[model samples]
Target: MTTSTTGGRTTVADTQNPPGATGGRGRSARKRRAILDAAREVFLRGGYLGTNMDEIAALSEVSKQTVYKHFGSKEALFVEIVTSMTSGAGDTVHDQLPQPARGDDLAQYLREYAYRQLTVVLTPDLMRLRRLVIGEVPRFPELARVLHEGGPARAMRSMAALFERLADEGRLTVDDPRTAASHFNWLVMAEPVNRAMLLGDEAIPSPQELRRHAADGVRVFLAAYGPGAGHAPR
Candidate 1:
């Protein structure tokens, strides 16, 4: 599969089979996965401008023509790398977020949710990819947009849905789930993510530290949106 971004929208192409295709579909898929894996490593080690198709092909153990046959250009491969990684991370966080249940400890649920999101997103590769995309914003602005939409925006939407459910259960006094979700998201993410991004991977918080941050963020969120908090719509 290959991806293209247009006007901040990403569309994937099914390039597993093309006209007069020679190899079997299984072989093509393996090559595609190999290329993506190799490209991801290369791009993360070296930013977009520094990466080359020849290096990627060599690492993947495929011919240069095979690399081009799978992903038309270096830019396309890079875009695919960004989209795949971000989307995969988003999916992991979304899928693992705990569902709010009646009589459930909302604070614990939210903390687990927040901590899961933080751990998934604060990985070395994802952080490096974020930095690389930011540096290339002027050249590949759409890539940055795609990264945000796929990672943060998607997470916010999932969070909004959870908040809406809590409100319906009278567990939260949310007036606007989206707004409440935004607050909860940045409350949990901003400090840790910024620290890691600016200060390097070594600056990433330990599990105990991240758990404390998640707990603190949940406390603040509940103060504003918890039952009887009287959080009015802005």
Candidate 2:
């Protein structure tokens, strides 16, 4: 579960200065890319409050003046990193779990979906991002809202929509699809994810372990919502 697949860097290259511009537009683009990449590493290591523009500039091999020219301020760069990371997670999860109209074999579908979600959330990079956001929340509370909307909220909506379709087809007895979706997603994630967040990535469940967790969650979900269970919201 590496964060290699999502949007790691966004280069605000100059369109006015073409790739072959004599004003060093090409150099500007390279420097911008370097600064962003360096910022990511530095921020991840030192966090938002601890990171400094000078450190980023030194790591990026650009002058501090150049770093300021590209990003303006440390807060602006940190904001981009967080927004891109969370937004990337949301977009990636939706792609993996497309809200289907309906499907058969309840346990299998849920197990697969759970595994996918687990995999994405348990990534080391995402886990670190979670820690960063939580640490930043006390001072920058709006960041928490951004994180929820970009990650968990988006994933839950996708799951809830799927549940609604399942209910419509009489495959599940869902009264509140959104709640059911949360229950299912959390069922598969709570223990392992909590362990990872609290105890570090080494505590994160292995692939086989995640499969078992997903399977167990699917079983519980089916017991409660499967067609003939009469399992109602309590």
Which candidate comes out best when scored by lDDT? 1
Q: What's the distance in Å from true for residue 124, model 2? A: 1.2
Candidate 2, position 26, lDDT: 67
lDDT of 1 by residue, 210-230 (tens): 999999999999999988996
* lDDT against the true structure, each candidate: 0.90, 0.83
Against the true structure, whose TM-score is highest?
Answer: 1
lDDT of 2 by residue, 6-114 (tens): 3766444455445666567668989998998899899988898889999999999999999999888898888878888888777776785645445456677678888
Prediction 1 global C-alpha lDDT? 0.90
**Every model's TM-score:** 0.88, 0.82
How far residue 118's Cα lies from its native spot in candidate 2, in Å, is 1.0
lDDT (Cα) of model 2:
0.83
* Clash count in backbone of candidate 1: 0
Q: What is the lDDT of residue 195 in candidate 1?
A: 99
Q: What's the CA error at residue 232 for candidate 1, in Å?
A: 3.8
Name the runs in model 2 displaced over 4 angstroms: 1-30, 98-104, 231-234
TM-score of 2: 0.82
In model 2, what is the error at residue 149, expressed in angstroms?
1.5
